[model samples]
Target: MDCLFCKIAEKEIPSDLIHEDEFVVAFKDINPQAPVHFLIVPKIHIKSLDQISKEDNALISHIFNLIPKLANELGIENGYRVVNNCGPDGGQTVDHIHFHVLGKREMLWPPG
Candidate 1:
């Protein structure tokens, strides 16, 4: 596929990787919104959260399980926000399903 996150997962594109396993890959966001900002993306190509199926449950669980560990390792355990923007109106720029792990600063309410 022509997905940007897919290419990063495949190592076809360079990224400042933070963590990786068989199920997912975490990397620093090129355009960080917070002092600590990174992305956790599934190795498998998933269009978006709304597209997830029952078969993807395990993958989703794995992604959640990895989030805290990554946050602690990245020293953002004190506070952080895990955001998954849905469709275009929801501000999902990329088609690939990915979680934005942002922290190191207080996240304002009603995020834009």
Candidate 2:
């Protein structure tokens, strides 16, 4: 597949990977918004949040279950933000689904 995250997950392209397991792949964000910014992407290609099926329940659950540990490991134990943009209006740039984890700074309300 031509998806960038797919390439990264497949090791077809290199990223500053922080974590990887059978269900997901994570790496530092290329354009970080905070001192600690990274992404968690599912290895399986899901076009967007709108596309997830009931069959994806376990995968989604696993992603949520893994986030805190990763956030702590990334040194954001004090606090962190997890964002998943669903569509164009929501600021989703890439087609593949991903969750942004960012912290080490005071997060503002009404995040733009």
Candidate 3:
């Protein structure tokens, strides 16, 4: 697969890894929008939020379950933003499913 996040998860590409497990991986975002900007992605490719199936329930839950711990570890316990862009109209740049975890700054309303 030519997916960038997949390459990173498989260690085929270098990334500043923050956390990893059998199910998911977290890493620093190269083009950061905030002081603390990272990405959380599933090891298995799911395309986008619109593609998620019932079979992905456990994996999705696992990802959410790790967010708080990851935020605390990264020192953004006070506040953070988790964003999942679904498609072109939704601002999704990568085909692989991923969530942007942003913090260390005030996230204004009416986000673009």
Candidate 4:
């Protein structure tokens, strides 16, 4: 219940929401790593991708289905990077299931 993304999704905390529906919300990252950086999060408080169950498959697909449209809306049609850090070792600072949409610059692989 004390989750940041959950608060944002519930409108308890203000975010620059670019997209939203009954199940998910998209908004700019507070600390951007690129010129175009935003986060796509589920309205339901999902701790991490590994925590997703078969029952959540539809929701997950729905989230992925919206990515391309969101990228275009953010003007990243040329290309973009979608990242989901899973755990502490994976550099996940936020304990929530979310995807980072980064663009506007060429991203290098094996990310330093």
Give all TM-scores, in the order shown. Answer: 0.97, 0.96, 0.97, 0.96
lDDT of 2 by residue, 24-69 (tens): 9999999999999999999999999999999999999999999999
lDDT by residue (85-105, candidate 4, tens digit) is 999999898899999999989
lDDT, candidate 4, at 79: 95
Q: Which stretches of candidate 4 lie over 4 Å from their true place?
A: none
| Model 3, residue 62: C-alpha shift (Å) | 0.4
Give stretches of model 2 more than 4 Å off.
none
lDDT of each: 0.94, 0.94, 0.94, 0.92
Candidate 1, position 31, lDDT: 98
Error of 2 at 84 (Å): 0.5
Q: Which residue pairs clash within candidate 4?
A: none
lDDT of 3 by residue, 1-112 (tens): 8999999999999999999999999999999999999999999998999999999999999999999889999899669999999999999999999999999999998885
RMSD of each: 0.8, 0.8, 0.8, 0.8
Alpha-carbon runs more than 4 Å astray in model 3:
none
Task: Report the error of model 1 at residue 88, Å.
Answer: 0.4
Candidate 1 regions off by >4 Å? none
